[model samples]
Target: MRPSLGRFGYPKSVRGYAVQAPGAPTLDVFSRRTKWLQKERAARDAETSRKVDYVRDEVAARLCERLLDIKRHFPHVLDLGANACNIARILTRPNPDSYSAAPVYEPLSSRVSALTAAESSRSLLHRDEDLPFNNEIAITRHLLASDETLPFAPHTFDAVLSSCSLHWVNDLPSVLTQVNNILKPDAPFMAAMLGGDSLFELRTSLQLAEMERRGGIGIHMSPLADVRDVGGLLQRAGFRLLTVDVDDIVVDYPDSFALMADLQAMGESNALAGRDVPPIRRDVLVAADAIYRALHGNDDGTLPATFRLIYMIGWKEAPQQAKPLERGSGMVSIKDVLEGQRTGGKSGNR
Candidate 1:
């Protein structure tokens, strides 16, 4: 299907999106964005550092345990779309063992360039290949949500780890195909992506102001891809024993402008798919900030912004499906399926 202008009058999918074969043009677009994301990486790290301390002190640390298990299976690993190379630096530290474990980050070319601005001080390496290493674990965070196509074959990876990245992607099924192809049979492809309930306050406020200001027409709000959808996606992708857990983090902002600044710092401001330029506003942005604050402001003069993050853990290194479900054997109950969701399970308490 041809790409169309979406609700905000911005172009939706680009021409020839969704990579159908190896060495396709879709690969070019994904590689090209690295230069831009690199510039913003520094700013984004700083913003998240300032406002998201709780996530750092608690929620984010649990990822280390997950990566440790993947490390045990495959000592060498690769991280794609490594913004600021933040995740790698956290996990690959303080290890003085003979295991010689290291994880590579394939950030977008733009982000790679930005890391260059720092010279040898960069965590992400500058490389975009079909596969970084042979017979190894390849993990990507939030890289799948943007592209309609991928540069991988089926069942190619030993293990895969994706965290907080897939919501930005467009074609769910096709992306899943690429993901499944690279993962070895019964090999767990554990990942965390944005769910349908993320950024509720920001999305609602921005939408209301846009409609009010423009007479029922406004720019499109970036859609939060669903976590529950991942279950079906995994089933169709032929993944088994899939487990998905949802978690929420409420990030409070001093005001709406502070939130907007952080998002801009993260290069997440644009909802337009074909946009190759940073969105420029020629008019007074302060007024728009004012309108946003007015609509989303709080009683204590603080805005409550909620971001939902889902954590998924599945094993891919296994070589076969357990077995097929007999027709109408009765769907599994929620309690039976979520048997592992106890203390220190995928779901952790506050």
Candidate 2:
């Protein structure tokens, strides 16, 4: 049975863990409350919030493009970790410019019969409800739920899509399992998250500054999943035909301070567990700014911050799905095929 939500919208079991016996082992890596607060604060400022949404919008469009490639219609889709309805907006809005270039492209809304946008922050979810697309036929429901604990029955959704979220989850493997569980058999799960190399410039600058100023360093940036391990995580979660790839989006800022401000507005600030350390001293921040410019400043008097987005596609297994042939079943020999090609000669007849 699923645990009921306790105060602050977390499962009762999660709150219980907070008071567990001392010295007990735990798997939690992020403070859910902190993340929720960050997102809520970001939503409160409408103008600044929209500014940082460009990244999410770009990623959402790319994810929707991948869905268009598959020739299947999703009767019901779940937008897990839906932040301000990025995926929903992309799916519902028609891009006449792109349609003119490629008439073969079909609108994502036509393919998606219905959508449920689920987000952890109530403020953000409420903000999503205010979007004009909610009146469209695509978005059918808005759910307030955490990615850590998905409240849904098995085989509920025909497909699942997430954009610019999931990296903040404390237990990613568990969440992926829930995603696979809710997806109907043979349904595809498409998502994109920040990879380990994301924001390396900021991370490095902060580390060096802290070390020089305080004689030590602290975790100023949240750790992210490495692309190398994403496929394994998907397979472990029972997702089949896994596809994983990475893309880097570099945005130039006037300096590190401006970049940090954007990150805060984007609700991408650090929310690591036990992150109670004092904020970076002003002197340290100044030193870090200098170091950042010296190390990675562009020739145009700006700094380049790279966000590496890791894209993953996996499918729920079904009996009808195609499977790889047995290893020794191949009749053709690669050695002979290569030799024939090298000689530019015919085989049996010649």
Candidate 3:
């Protein structure tokens, strides 16, 4: 169902884990304790010297492509859930290393102003948090804000972009609808979120191991949004000319343990509020490891883990932009076209 722009209230707060109504779709699932998730992410960022922000880097690269394709420079950009201001650095950094560089795009640092947020304002950046982009210009403004509640005014930005972060929000549609309302007319919006297929092998192995040992599988991974549902979400949030695409990135790991470690380091580990089980037993871990190796191990001894990044781009509706054609206005008939193709095939056979 489409989210209404007229709705102004945020989601109701609940203590601990809370489940929706019995018949509600699984996508509407809730997480009651995202505070720990936020803290975990902040702690991860704080520990790293350079911040191994691969997902954020990938997100910035894709947003750069969108900037190139649209041929528009947004003077006032907002980086939603902008962890460490990575997108800001990508869009602004001069003479970035080849490993993370894009085409010589416009200098967003000079022209575009942005607001970014971490779990808290203090935890936004690494070592260079206080330092500006360079000596001359200011970096993206960092704030303390949660996805469920944005502390900004309406029509505040020309563009809104996020990377690998929105998937963790408990009330995604509400956050998105708020984003829609705050963007100026004709503004560009893009985001990348983790998709449903991420960590398939690990999820499978864990479930199998848990069921065998404890007669049930507890939540071990966060629920991910399906790529199929995102386009509809953009429309529901009142976006136009929406485009949604998925990029599947497979990384080879020495084993499932290494993959899990990386996930923990990246603060992408399970933080589901509905998880009812206690910490997994050592036997369960060994069994899951064996199961993973049997089911998805590589000949070279490296296991593969998939990270599906679903990228969505849309525009705030504008009066000047073109709209889709009305139903029944098409000039061609499908039946006639099929018949013509059939006749042509028969003539070719003769």
Candidate 3 has its poorest 10 consecutive residues by lDDT at 113-122
| Angstrom error at residue 86, model 2 | 0.1
Clashes of 1: 32
Give model 3's clash tally: 0
State the lDDT of candidate 1 residue by residue for 1-350, as single tens digits.
75678999888855676666653233222222543463346344554533433443233344444555433344323333344333343343343122345654322221111111011113222222122321122334333333445555665555555544455555556666676677667666666665777777776665555555654534434666677677887777666777778778777788776776666554445454554544434232444556556776777788776778777765543545575578778555556446646433444321
**What is residue 230's positional error in candidate 3, in angstroms?**
1.2
**Each prediction's TM-score versus the true structure:** 0.59, 0.86, 0.78
What lDDT is reached at residue 50 by model 2? 84
Model 3, global lDDT? 0.71
Encode model 2's per-residue lDDT on 224-331: one tens digit a residue: 999998999999999998899999999999989999999999888999989888888899999999999999999988999999999999999999998778999988
Q: What is the lDDT of residue 171 in candidate 2?
A: 76
Residue runs of model 3 more than 4 Å from their true location after superposition = 1-51, 93-121, 124-137, 331-350
Q: Which of the numbered candidates is closest to the native, going by highest TM-score?
A: 2
User: What is the Cα-based TM-score of model 3?
Assistant: 0.78
Ranking by TM-score: 2, 3, 1
Which scores greater on lDDT, model 2 or model 3?
2
Worst 10 residues of 2 by lDDT: 15-24
Clashing residue pairs in all predictions, respectively, total 32, 0, 0
* Candidate 1 lDDT for residue 78: 33
Q: lDDT for every model? A: 0.50, 0.86, 0.71
